[model samples]
Target: VWSREEEVRHGTYRPQSSAQLKATLGKDGKISAWRTDYVQSGDAEGETSFIYAIPATSRRHFSYQSNQRDGPWRSVNSTQIGFYNESFIDELAQAAGEDPYQFRRKHLAADSRHLKVLDTVAKRAGWGTPLPEGVGRGIAIVESFGTIVAEVIEATVREDGSPQVLKAWAVVDCGTTVNPLNAEAQIAGGMVMGLSSAIGEAITIDKGAVVQSNFNDYNILKLAGAPAVIDVHFIESGAKMGGIGEPGVPPASPALANALFAATGKRIRTLPLMTQAKA
Candidate 1:
């Protein structure tokens, strides 16, 4: 990940690119048998650690090389990571000659809770249904801050190299949801922001200041570009309570990316779709 730059004094330097990451995913599409290498690119701020949520019979490993800066921030960055990781997973599924939704469902069998959301979202999005050429449906699932969110997006790729999202469906399991209205709004807001970033939000550094200062330069999802329909469903699984704020964001970006790949047969490794693959 590349960090932003800021200056405290003229002709002086302050660096933020303090951490670098490399990861490898193994076959079978599970988090098992994978490795991640992280290096600290600057002065040491604190110690680094690795956390894994492996059930029995799992084999996932990670390594961290730290000089130090600060721990990675959540919210925004988590969405980016989800976009990168889940998109790659979809590619793997396609390479294996399997439907992306079914591929993920097969791998997530261990966690019935996760499967619940995945199955529900896919059903709501009409998974396995036929679509016109150049149109595709994509599904992605993420657990953020203990809340599990699964999203499915329907999108079409136009000849002009632009992608238009048609509809979005989400199934969130945050345990017993206290307030249904608030949870739905939270999830919908995350989906909008996530789609906006995936479609047209790019940031670059020049000298030491941000090149795009305002919305005019940093384009966002306009009314016409936003999804025509969005459905958010909550599952009262009676599990442990979880946060609803950020969980919805991660799946939004990845689901959109996967849908684009399905439509165009091209993978997008970078944000702001136009950067790598056109349309």
Candidate 2:
């Protein structure tokens, strides 16, 4: 944590700032220590748009094993933060010269319960199997509000540079679920919402006005563009009850991004994976 005096001395505390973070992982593939610092380049002005912390996404649970913020509970918050954190997890896996799935497994020693969902989802998705060129598979596990969800996404980057989600599998552990059908529906809806945000949804500002006002202009996922199959599997972990609605939203983006990376060897660092061209 940088104090205001140290921030001013280092010219880092200001309205507009950019930050860089570093992570040190132990031999066991868990983070040992993490540090980030902000570098501000603008005047100390009216409203600040710069802040940073350990991401409060579901991935936070993983880092607790390594010894690692709370904020408003929102689906989009988890979606966006999970997107970022899980993408980095894949990168770290790659950097360690390990398969992403295996890398995640190595770091799951702290919680076999989490691994339960991961193993189920991976088996359903056929992890470690090879796919045809232009097709890729990615995996993500998220625990939110005591409900854990592990999802696998299979995506194909078409010749025309479009990305298509072929299938999705979600293994959920929302303990003592009362209504299985409604939980399935909520998880499915959350997955669709997360995928839409990851694939095509965006908001723009033009001339001090909002650009996208409705569904037509907003460009959400259409029925024809939806995944061919989305399988939701529930695991009654016999723990206390948990909600199902929001946990499903967070992993969709990262799983899709990881799938794209696997398929094309092109890592995605931003949202809306289709908008960017392969390098």
Candidate 3:
């Protein structure tokens, strides 16, 4: 789950969602087939939330609508789906006794842009390298609005059992990056927001009235809690134009979740991870 947004957007905020993704592996531990069944319900009428996953066939996207319009925040639905699906992927890898990084590699197509981005991040972040005690690294890949992005985060367990994010690495294959500097800023900002909400951010309700009225009782990822370093790398797949702003937000939280499980051996099943401290 995630921090639920207020019902103020022209575009629906991402609804609380549930999904089950099942994959079958061959004898060599390669994914021979996979399928995802997604569900979204219990929302109000006229709610038109949507999520775009990996297309199974060649396709052309003719229209281009950015997700930054006044009331239509980008990637709300994608972020929810990424968190659930990617976290499930990590859990599957763990259950199968396979390295998460290597497991994803075996499933991706050799020539796809998604694979390239995933490979880029893993190699640059030294995916297979050893880490000091109590250190854990996690990776996640997500595709939305014509972009394929991969992220790797390294975290450590604090003395009190809380997780401390030290660094993050992101690789983007967004078909084309119009402006390198702007793209970098977009991804970095998205990651910061993603981590911010994942750590601690929520809007409670009591008797149909809002509970968190201001920042005083609410949560935010202050500077003191942010990752010290975030590195962004881009790959121009040259297939078609894609939105840079929306794609970056989906990967950060899931990568952090996987990282936490690795650092503490506890699977995360809720949001505002502080609520499940040391998880």
Clash tally, candidates in order: 4, 0, 0
lDDT of 3 by residue, 214-252 (tens): 466667878877889889999877889887887888888
Candidate 2 per-residue lDDT, tens place, 123-240, comes to 9888988888778999987776667788999988766777788999999988888999999999998998888878887555466444655676667899877899999999888988
Pairs of residues at least 3 apart in sequence or in different chains that clash in candidate 1: 33-59, 44-67, 161-279, 162-279
Q: Please write out the lDDT profile of model 1 over residues 16-99, one tens digit for every residue.
A: 221222333456544443333222233222221112232323222233443223344335345644654577668767766788
Worst 10 residues of 2 by lDDT: 61-70
- On the 0 to 100 scale, the lDDT of residue 74 in model 2 is 39
Stretches of candidate 2 exceeding 4 Å from the true structure? 1-21, 27-30, 35-76, 277-279
What is the overall TM-score of model 3 with all chains considered together? 0.80
lDDT of 3: 0.73
Return the TM-score for each candidate structure. Answer: 0.77, 0.77, 0.80
- The model with the greater lDDT, 2 or 3, is 3
Order of quality (lDDT): 3, 2, 1
Residue 12 lDDT in model 2?
15
TM-score of 1: 0.77
Query: For this target, which candidate reaches the highest lDDT against the unseen true structure?
Result: 3
Question: Listing every candidate in turn, what is its Cα RMSD in Å to the true structure after a full C-alpha superposition?
Answer: 6.3, 11.2, 7.0
